[model samples]
Target: MKKALRWISKNLIKIYAFLGFTYLFIPIIYTFVFSFNKYVRSNLVWKSFTLENWKNPCKPIDICSALGNSIKIGLLATAGATLLGTLIAFALARYAFKGRGFVNTLIFLPMATPELVLGASLLTMFLNLGFNPGFWTIVIAHVMFCISFVVVTVKARIASLDPRLEQAAMDLYANEHETFRRVTLPLVAPGIAGGALLAFSLSFDDFIITNFNSGTTMTFPLYVYTHEKGGLPAQANVIGFSMFFLALLIVIAGQIVGRKRKVSA
Candidate 1:
């Protein structure tokens, strides 16, 4: 008993990490496994395995349309948020302006506020402005929340940037625009990319805010939630798993590129 206790104590952190990873990945594993299940209506129970679901992920009713809407909104929101947030980050990092602290505090409000509250507030604001909820509304709502995260991410990167690099560029006869376009932008590109990716993911995965503003329009999350009683289609699982794998591949590729850059440098 004492030996077992001692061994467990020594290996506690490893055991905890293993369990944590297992818990996090269990849903992903379940989704992947169920993606291959042969089901006519409900995919709750495991049937014979088949690759048809993978072959036709869009076979399910309206799933593809919903996915397309999500993709469109994600892209638009990511673009808007990343552009605006990167500017804000640069401004906050580089300049001292009136009410800068107030602006900085406001940026965190959306992130700190609960989704339910934020969504409701947005809905109310839209209604007051005589605007109808739909695709644009969803995109607007997503961009609003996503901007906070993007700003936080890019700001951290800006804060970490070395001033000497820009100074050196200026010393070499590079003008402000030339230095920013050539050196500053490239140095900050990774953070901007990271922020854009994060914003896209958040917009895609969002349900509460989308639901509040979606009106008759449906997104993937909405479709999944609405179909929960009838059991989600195998195609849904296939699409879900495919997205997960795609994101995983992108991360792996990014890591490889980073390693190569490091070696070359």
Candidate 2:
């Protein structure tokens, strides 16, 4: 009994970790497997596997259009949010000015606010301003929320940087602009890239805010939501798997590049 108790206690954490990983990966596995499903209008069961689904990933016309919209909006929103947020982060981390505290507090408010509330409020404001909720409105809404996350992420990176690096650059007769361009920008670039990736992912995966702001615009998530009732097609799963693989490749490439740079240094 004592030996059995010891074994159980030793392996308990490993057991829990295995179960947790299993829980997370089951859906991903299901999606990847079903992407090869042979079906029409429903993919709830395994109806044999074929390469046709992968070949005809855009079989449904609307799905491709929705994916395009999602990609467009995500890219635009990420660019806008990353640029604005990087500026804000630099200001908060490097400057002391009037209303600094207030600005810092205000930036966090959007992140704290619920998505539903933010969406509804944005929708209401657009209506009041006589602006139609479409591509631009969705982009605006995504940027508004994404900027907060970007600011927080980049600000942390900025805050952790050593000011002595900039001081050394200036001591070498480099002006402020030159120092920022050569030294500061390079050092903080990883953080900016991380924040932009995060912003893009958040914008792409968002459903609630997009639903509220995307009037007559069908995003990938919205399409999935609507079609799930009728059973999602294998093409949808193909898109999901494709996105996962794309992201995986990007990450792997970044890691390889980082390793090479480190070895060269």
Candidate 3:
């Protein structure tokens, strides 16, 4: 009876997994399908299909501009956050420091808070300091959320590192800076790269914080939200489907590179 019940539980977990996957993917599939729709309604029927939306000509000019800004903000924020987070992680994971717990807690607090609350609080603080919520504000807000992820990822990487390398380097009369550059860094570089890529992905996809701090800024996600609220647009589906294709391509490219590396090894 116990074995039978265990078997039933395993089958039930598989069923639940399928249901969850379906729930997640159905909307994305629908969005991709309707990207080619002739009509812009929320629902897509068999009769509607067109490529005009994807191959569109534009006059409003905001989409292109917003795309540029989003890329800019993502790159800048990712770069800044990755650099700062890596430094902090190295310090924390390599050395015993005063107020380490307090500092770590403070560092992680932004990530734990709701995006809406973070955005609102930052907006208020920036406004109080006579800075407006706009492009740079959005970048800063993105950095706040993104940095914690980097710190956590890189800290784990550093924590897992062999301290013997540093000890050996010191025995060879290498300075702390030299040891860090030569020994500590190369070992953790892959993890840091992975973390930064992840941070870029998160910053790029963010909508809630972007929306609150954007002011006049129109990121792709914000653009989608705006058009979605106004009424559905064929162009929205086209953008979404494009993102899906881009994500798929990235996944495939990573797999190919990974396989090639394995073959090389």
Candidate 4:
């Protein structure tokens, strides 16, 4: 009876695991299906599949332009945020100074602020300064949020690292810059990269802040929101699936590279 009970427990656990996986992936599956549905109307009618959204030229070109702009903004914002974040992390993790706690809290204020609040504040500031809300303004707003994430991730990594490694390198006759270049940078690179990826994804996926500050610009998410009043779109489904697969591929590649480096070491 005990063995039977154990067997039942194992089977129930497997069933629950399968259910969780299905729950997680159902949206992806539905999104793919809806992308191919011939029924553009949101009616519950189940019907034949169509690929018109992907191949049709009559469809809005704003999506293509938005994709380009989003990638460009993601790159720029990621670079700006990562560089500033790295510096701030190094300062906080490696140095002691007056008002350290206050400074750290200030750095987090932007991150903790709600997106709507941040966007509204930025909009007000830009108007007050007579600055037109444009691509650069949007990028700056995004960087404000992205930098905090980078700082937290990198600071945690730096805190976990032993300082002795750099001291040992210095003792072996390496200059301060050389020691950092050879030892410290490489060691903290993963966290930096992970943070950069997070930054890029955040910039790419941003909608509320982008909408408030985009002015004449249109990002992918903004475009989606603007056009959503018509109905949930088939093209949107396609884009959603594509992004999911692309991000998944990049994550898998990063893991493989990290593992290879670990094995080589």
Per-residue lDDT for 256 in model 3?
Answer: 96
Candidate 1 lDDT, 82-123, residue by residue in tens: 999999999999998999879989998888899999999999
Ranking by lDDT: 2, 1, 4, 3
Q: For residues 1-265, could you state the per-residue lDDT of candidate 4 as single tens digits?
A: 9999888797998888999999999989987777777764551355777778657622656777887889999999999999999999999999989999897998889888999999998999999999999899999999998999999999999988998999999999999899989999999998899899999999999999898999999888987787777665567777777888899998999899889989998
- Alpha-carbon lDDT, every model: 0.93, 0.93, 0.82, 0.87
Worst 10 residues of 2 by lDDT: 40-49
Off by over 4 Å in 4: 1-22, 41-46, 56-58
Candidate 3 lDDT, 63-157, residue by residue in tens? 66776787899899999989988988888887887899898898878878998998888888887899878998998888889988999999999
Compare candidates 1 and 3 on TM-score and give the better one.
1
- Regions of candidate 3 where Cα sits further than 4 Å from its true position: 1-19, 40-47, 57-61, 164-178, 262-265
Worst 10 residues of 4 by lDDT: 38-47
Error of 4 at 12 (Å): 8.2
Give candidate 3's root-mean-square deviation (CA, Å): 3.6
Per-residue lDDT of candidate 2, residues 109-168 (tens digit): 998899999999999999999999998999999999999899999999998899999999
For TM-score, candidate 2 versus 3, the one ahead is 2
RMSD (Cα, Å) for all candidates, in order, is 2.1, 2.3, 3.6, 2.6
Error of 3 at 168 (Å): 5.6
Q: Report clashes for each candidate as comma-separated counts.
A: 0, 0, 0, 0
Model 1, total clashes: 0
